[model samples]
Target: MNDVPVAVAAMPSAEGTAVARAAAVVGGPPAVRCTGLARRFGRRWAFSRVDLEVAAGARLLIMGANGSGKTTLLKVISTLIPPSLGAVQIFGHDAGADPAAARARLHLLSHSAGLYEDLSGADNLLVLSRLLGRPLVDPVALLARVGLAPRPEPVRTYSAGMRKRLQLAALLLKDPPLTLLDEPFAALDPAGCGAVEALISGLSGTVIVASHQVGRAARLCDHALLMHEGAARWQGPAARAVEAYTALHGIDNADGGG
Candidate 1:
């Protein structure tokens, strides 16, 4: 791990205690930390006074109904959107001010492919690889690594799971230390879900994933967050959260409490 290259992206929680802890104990900083994090649209509050921390090798699962500010929180942590209040730092770099630096080590995956549908898989990899200024890897090989065949069809023809695998390949190639995943299980078959979950588990980084599937969340995370109305109603072990959540709000029902 000593030879592992430093990340080029902005790290979101590499400062304060996290930095000291990471540097002293192992190889990198804690995965993420959000302190008093909030977002507001005029008088409306998307979220407020949120505080959380994740350690190296930690996986955090976030669960919430729609409009609960789940995506908002992820965006704020990933440097994609600025918080109306509070600060986010990665590896001691300011995510808002030094996004490029933070992004050097950060990987974020969402429903959007973030690929050029008009281009080949190789082309997509080459483009983003160049953009990130990392070592250029063979695109065909990358596709194969993700279990996609080297076909001539444009990325537009890829199935949802294939696209997800491609995006996952890109993240894997980067070997980033911090990853943010949003609803990665959508449209995936049971086998596909297992594949994705295994890939996530194998990634040697700190991961934060947002998903509605309590089963996957429980398997992939050391802890889980129950977000409702833009705040965390409960935060603790993934299994405990699942049990508590089931008790508080059954699989058939939807509300916030346990």
Candidate 2:
């Protein structure tokens, strides 16, 4: 089996670490705030009347079954789509009124890798950096940080795990303060999963992960939100959220271990 290379023990830079420490000490507005948030496609409500608040430097786990609106909630918070009702704020900036500001402060890793299939992995990062109006940082270093070697081959030939690694590199390049990850553990091997978990553990900014890998993800998070039928069923300690999820679903083992 060809496993993707992952720098499992990679550490953030001194500047990154300082920024995280400062944010924690300053104690400013919540990193993410949503009031009566809702989204709809025609007549079907993807999610409705959801209220959420995540403090700075907190890790939040969003758990739900398929079609439970986990992806939709992340999208709205990321400013990729507008909420049909209510409002969203990122770092105290109203997402609807100031989308650019909100977007500048957050990074969203969705189901799609969002890479240019025809471009090399390095080139993809460079292009994205340019498009986002960020400085031209070293793509090779970014790729290396994510345990992906610089390759001349276009992303079209890369494996699913490789693409995911490249996406991670992109996330590093942006280095946004608020990160929204949707199913980050999917399409990854044990090593890749471990690498992702490590990366999340090191993030100093606010993180919200939507995942089904309950056992591993919950432990890494300080808070958890459980979604059921397009609504938030529970929100509190990560362990209790896991218990509520398992009890509601009647599962003996949610993800094998907590």
In model 2, the worst 10-residue window by lDDT is 2-11
What lDDT would each prediction earn against the true structure? 0.72, 0.79
TM value for model 2? 0.88
Top TM-score hit: 2
Clash count of each predicted structure: 16, 0
Q: Please provide, for model 1 over 1-258, each residue's C-alpha lDDT reduced to its tens digit, 9 standing for 90 to 100.
A: 111111212223221111211222255555666667889888998877777766665667787766778888888888888999887777667787888888887888887888899987777888888887777757787778778888778899889988998888888778788889988787888777877877887776677888767665556666678787877778766656566566656674322211
Question: Which regions in candidate 1 have their CA more than 4 angstroms from the true location?
Answer: 1-29, 252-258
Worst 10 residues of 1 by lDDT: 1-10
Given candidate 2, what's the lDDT at residue 167?
87
Overlapping backbone residue pairs in candidate 1 total 16
